[model samples]
Target: MESTGIQRLFYILWAIIKLNLYILVFTLAGGIVLGMGPAFQSANDVLLTSGMDYQNITFGKMAERFKANFKRSNGIFWIFAALLGIVAYNLFLASQIKGLLWFILSFVLFFAILLLLVVYLYAVQYETTYDISIGNLLKLAFISVFLNFGTFLKVLFGVISILVVTWFFKGLLLFATFSLFLVWSGYATKNIRQLVEGKLG
Candidate 1:
């Protein structure tokens, strides 16, 4: 029998609120790192570069290290997501659907791409002149990944896609990215539950 809209809404709400604390633990940890790492690096550069040591510290070298670190920092996020996927796969024995896998895979790819682009952004900053070519590509790649993750990004895209859409918008675009996090969590929960039951039961 087809479920009523009320029932569906209830399910979604249940999923969203059910032990949100646990989900946020992982998400927030990842999000915080994603949000703060760059600022941290910038501060690091400022602090260490003080007292007339700026000449020794080259922008080109600094950019590469920063880009690589950002890529790896966000790599940590993807690693978390991948772990979630493995857990889900273990729980659910149902035939895999292309639809759901698409979502899962897309998220991974997008996250990784964003990380790479961020790395590239820092990496390119060390160039001799103020050339925008490298920075532009990094910006484009960053926005593409952010947009792939959620509905909020869509709304965000609609607003800024025109002006900043040329290469991309600056700053972290994760403002409302957590809106559908519950859905991702729910899907992960459901599949993992299925996989666990299949093995144990």
Candidate 2:
């Protein structure tokens, strides 16, 4: 049992490493700005399809998935990126103010950022797993975040934990941080996706 467990652990680690490398290479292939969106989309698709087992992961598969959704992925990526930029700019402006108004604005802006992050997380998964139009995909993903608030909290905690671990290790940022994040997000949001699907159907 101990040997089997150790082997499983090794296998997962190796898979994550390979995934990280795939994401990096593909992201650069699209020239970073263009590459990033498809890279993440492909990663999520590959991970979900494989049931997180990562045993069937390959460069060819990643490339195929990346090319499959190249344009759509970039559209989704830019839409959220613009929203994030606006919120971040507001956050920076809020930091310049003082007293209670600053506190209030800061709180609201931060929450908005969180909500956006949650929606983006769900958006990627939804796009990968379903055939919904981009408009509805974003709308449903935004709504699902609130409907599945408990799961959202779990995802939030998992993200923080991963960030904390990576902060200390540093190297994990390059090697496993994103792959691990995609794994956690996929697992955490599985039920939420099912619930959303059932309701929509």
Model 2 CA lDDT for position 102: 94
Taking the tens digit of each residue's C-alpha lDDT, what string does model 1 give over 1-201? 357877776654443332232223333444665633332333233223431233343445444435544653354344444655654554343234357876676566555444553333232222211233544534433443343345323433443343354236422133221313222322223333344336445
Tens-digit lDDT track of model 2 for 72-153 = 9999999999999999899999988899989899999988887887788899989987887899989988888888679999
Off by over 4 Å in 1: 1-3, 27-140, 143-153, 157-177, 181-201
Error of 1 at 78 (Å): 13
Looking at model 2, report the run of 10 residues with the lowest lDDT sum. Answer: 46-55
What is the lDDT of every predicted structure here? 0.38, 0.88
Over all chains combined, what TM-score does candidate 2 have?
A: 0.96
Q: What is the lDDT of residue 56 in candidate 1?
A: 41
After TM-score superposition, the amount by which residue 116's alpha carbon in candidate 1 deviates from its true location, in angstroms, is 14
The residue pairs in collision within model 1 are 67-119, 91-192, 91-194, 91-195, 91-196, 92-195
Off by over 4 Å in 2: none
